[model samples]
Target: MHDVTSQAGFASPDLSAFCRLDELGLVAVGQRLEPDRAVLACRVVEPDQWCRRCGCEGVPRDTVTRRLAHEPFGWRPTSLEVIVRRYRCSGCGHVWRQGTSLAAEPRAKLSRRGLRWALEAIVVQHLSVARVAEGLGVAWDTANDAVLAEGRRVLIGDRARFDGVAAIGVDEHVWRHTRRGDKYVTVIIDLTAVRAGTGPARLLDMVAGRSKQAFKTWLADRDEAWRDGIEVVAMDGFTGFKTAAAEELPGAVAVMDPFYADVLVMPMSVVFALLRGLSGAVRSA
Candidate 1:
């Protein structure tokens, strides 16, 4: 036989090297790029899957292909046609499908990376939900739901975000500016980093109404450690907020924000000073 081993080095190009699916525990077996879209055929790298109940090794039974939306590649929306293998445990006779970390929770149409990309596009790039949906090749509701769920899970649900909070700012925001009704919300902001000159402030939470009860309830919900860590609370000239802070955060120093004080108090002080000076000048003249 003519040395067939020499041809091994001249084999076809490896698509996995370019696709970088290995980071998600997946391998690109094939690819098809078109003018409008691109499809990547992939398979999980895990050869051995265990039974859910028995914890025994599973044997391959068959494979089913599923199409999932992935992040766009060079302005073209990419889709992954993954071949998931069904397995049956030889010891316990249980059946299950191979799982990979490429996608979010099971049965989700969007991949984890796609969800992340959509969130960044909305929050950082300031893109609308419709535009993000269009870019991801998904419906508006699909994109909105995925982004909201992921944001809550990754950012809002993280309890560690409340840590290191030393200072806070509370104010009332007009949520609805219609003539029908005045709907206001109590907005709490973390001003620790801003006070320390380390980073910009971050929003802590928002309650439905602008009342002492609302603010007090929110403060009461926090753990003692978090409540104890609060040192300063900057707020507008709202007596309800001041009362709430006094009751809930006894050790915290409540102060009026400079903007409100300057606007409401400084102007009158300046006018009074000017009138007194003019009166004295009139008497002298």
Candidate 2:
């Protein structure tokens, strides 16, 4: 719980912004929270958009419905009541109840605000799903699902915006629980000058595997225009990525830089030993 002093109130400075009423097609009807601030309630309405049926636009019908639950609203850590509507499409015989306009998907347990908060926890705070759930007072499954959904959204959104990328860096990371084996996630980084320094190094838009089909699909998904702009691809001598890069970006230069090994100066067998020694020293200290 947060304290409401003269300087700060229960209502967050960005509360209105988080609601994104205009974006959601709703105006903030009202807000209610006790002085102690145990809970905060908000009401939302559907906005004017095309019909889910015949694509005809709609106005607010007289009929309204009330939905109750905890909806994420940024880091305010409060609940929400998303009130929806019953819309009658003019173009077709469709009479359907409209869903929440704020969330990307209807009936999403996590609101857009909650999704942002959880993503911040994973990407910025570097907190695991279990820890985030404990802190946010949500179930572990809920937090984990939110993270996965948001991760996919980020990967898709960022990839869609990439254009005229001159260079790319590809790498792999292990992402399985309680496994020391071969499960991996392939991440494609935009090595373009504009995307330098921890920019868009998340998972690429593809299925995770070291197989030829996985890499091929990733390459095939890219626009042919991307191949023309790509000048170079730097990878850690992985034959799979190397092959894919060559086949997909025929014009691009492929550099199998051993520097990607992190300790290219040493043999692969000795690198693990070195890492263990470093970990042991840190633990002892």
Candidate 3:
């Protein structure tokens, strides 16, 4: 009998089977590696569920449509054309459009495949979404939506499993550039042992504002276990973040390196080495 790992070797046909193609034509196109190890790529296509009001599948009086690309579940690239049909229910005469899918909302143009590519470029390669979209021959909205969607999706699971968080990093950057008004985003990082790998960083959250109230409310939502595990915080010299961390996570170390800047601005070689060191320390401790 072939060992499971041996059966899953790169050269084996199991790779293709891993990416199961459904009737709707979503295809798994790539694979990503993680240190802890999990399934590589397994893209599957699924049809949209019917509306409760009408009890009709893909039924429509007036058609409205949108498409979106979402982050891969594992190694599979994914995409969906989310359609919302405005239908007058034959039974009740009520007219309404259907709800959006949790995976991709209605009216988006990027496929889940496109989203994964864009995000991988941003997270692993440090390439901006704009550049990734440009290279992929897609629109700016597609790239931006992919980033936002992926960020939310990953954050949900990561937030649930987070524990033993000794240190954290809170920082902000301009998510979208506008020459005129305020367009900043705050990123909260969980520097914990579980995130010490080739997978994505321990992103706690991202919010639009740079306010004390916003950060305070956000910090207050965490459980005592996570809050207590945090021993140190490294952040830019932002008083709002510093204050929130101090107030919410008492007795936690606050490391302010005001001179350092965004992840994009840092050298890749240096960043990877430092991250590896952080990972090692976290794993050991």
Best by TM-score: 1
**Per-candidate count of clashing residue pairs (backbone under 3 Å):** 0, 0, 13
Pairs of residues at least 3 apart in sequence or in different chains that clash in candidate 2? none
Q: Which stretches of candidate 1 lie over 4 Å from their true place?
A: 1-20, 172-185, 237-239, 256-285
Off by over 4 Å in 3: 1-112, 126-147, 156-158, 179-181, 194-201, 257-285
- Please list all clashing residue pairs in model 1, or write none if there are none: none
Rank candidates, lDDT, best first: 1, 2, 3
Summing lDDT over every window of 10 consecutive residues in candidate 3, give the lowest-scoring window: 276-285
lDDT of candidate 1 over 55-131, digit per residue (tens)? 98888899999777788867578888888899999899998888865555677878877777777776656566667
| Per-residue error (Å), model 1, residue 175 | 5.6
2 or 3: which has the higher TM-score? 2
TM-score of each: 0.76, 0.60, 0.48
lDDT assessment of candidate 3: 0.53
Residue runs of model 2 more than 4 Å from their true location after superposition: 1-37, 45-76, 84-99, 157-159, 180-182, 194-207, 211-213, 220-225, 256-285
Residue 88 lDDT (model 3): 65
